[model samples]
Target: MKVGVVDVGSNTVRLLVASVGSGEVRSLEEGRAHLGLGEEILLHGRIRRRKLDELDAVVTEFARIARKHRVRELETVVTAPGRQGGESERLLEVLRRATDGPVRVVSAENEGRLAYTGAVARTSVGPGVVAVCDVGGGSTEIVVGTALLGPAWVRSVDIGSLRLTASLLHGNPPTRTEVESARASIREAFSGIAPPAPELALATGGSARAIARIVGGAYDAE
Candidate 1:
């Protein structure tokens, strides 16, 4: 069956159109756009018209691609953007019009679990009490479970790279102060985090992979 997944985040919007089933899945189309939905909302409590326009474009494009792929069912998932109030309704209305489809306002915890299931289906790491972290432009989710996939606990924090970058870091490499501040905030959120008695942690996010690539690149350039 053809399935489409759209994640409307704080900094960007993304679409994943794929064909799935029978233990096999392939992405037929994907799209992304920078909308900055959480910029002013983090500071204030609303989204600006400029950012709304950006989101419209992203949603329109995603709609086109999904139609082009002839997807049967499209499932769009939205996180904190809808619950933030202050301006969530307006933004959601705009996006719904852009696609003329249902937009699901998923709780942070549920979003975390779904995303983990999707990603882990692609790659399940070493056997143990697996702790999964999926971070986006607006929130970070941590799920702890056993090798048998029994539930342990799930947590969601409102801190993403863009959120940190805007509120704290403003440089490409981010200053020491910014990094330290960001770390402090993340620690506060994960203060109770114990990793479900796991041996190691599994981190999944653009920030993690990008940092890894850049570090490797720097070493190779030497």
Candidate 2:
């Protein structure tokens, strides 16, 4: 069967059209739109009308692409923005109208588990304690588990690239003071959570992918 999955995240809206059957999945099409909903929410405590309108257009386009691919089923999942106090109902209504499908607002725990599963499935990690880190616009989820058993421990921190950038990095180039401040804030946020030592660490999500491209090589825990 062909499935279309849409992720309405804090920083971007992403679409994936894939063929799934017999425990195999093949990507048919993918698309992304940077809506920066997290920035808007952080600034105004809710997604503004303008950003919502933009998200509607992007989701519509994704639906069109899915239809073009003749997908049999469509699913939309929303993250941080949905968890945050915001105009999520209005935003979800717009997404539902665009995709003509059920739109689910998943919790942080679900997000962490999903991300961990996806990452471990794609990597070459063997049975052992494998840590998966999914850094999004509004939160960072760290999950530790054995490859054979799945996630045993999951922690979600309310600090991410976009959130940190909005809160501390005001300058265009981000002065040294601003950088230190952001680092300190992130350190404080991670101080309480302790993840088990892992045989391998896998990074997932937009920010990690971007870093991989810049680094120009396979991702390594080192």
Compare the candidates by lDDT and give the number of the best one. 2
Q: Score residue 183 of candidate 2 by CA lDDT.
A: 88
lDDT of 1: 0.76
> How much is 106 displaced in model 1, in angstroms?
1.6
**Local error of candidate 2 at residue 167 (angstroms):** 1.4
How many pairs of residues collide in model 1? 0
Clashing pairs for predicted structure model 1, backbone only:
none
RMSD of 2: 1.5
Candidate 2 on 121-218: residue-level lDDT in tens?
Answer: 87788778999999999999999998799999999998888999999999999999999999899899999788999988888887898998899646
Which regions of candidate 2 fall more than 4 Å away from where they truly are?
A: 216-222
What is the per-residue lDDT of model 1 for residues 10-85, given as tens digits with 9 covering 90 to 100? Answer: 7668899999899888988888876677776887678878777878888888888898888888767787677663
- lDDT of each candidate versus the true structure: 0.76, 0.90
Candidate 2's TM-score: 0.95
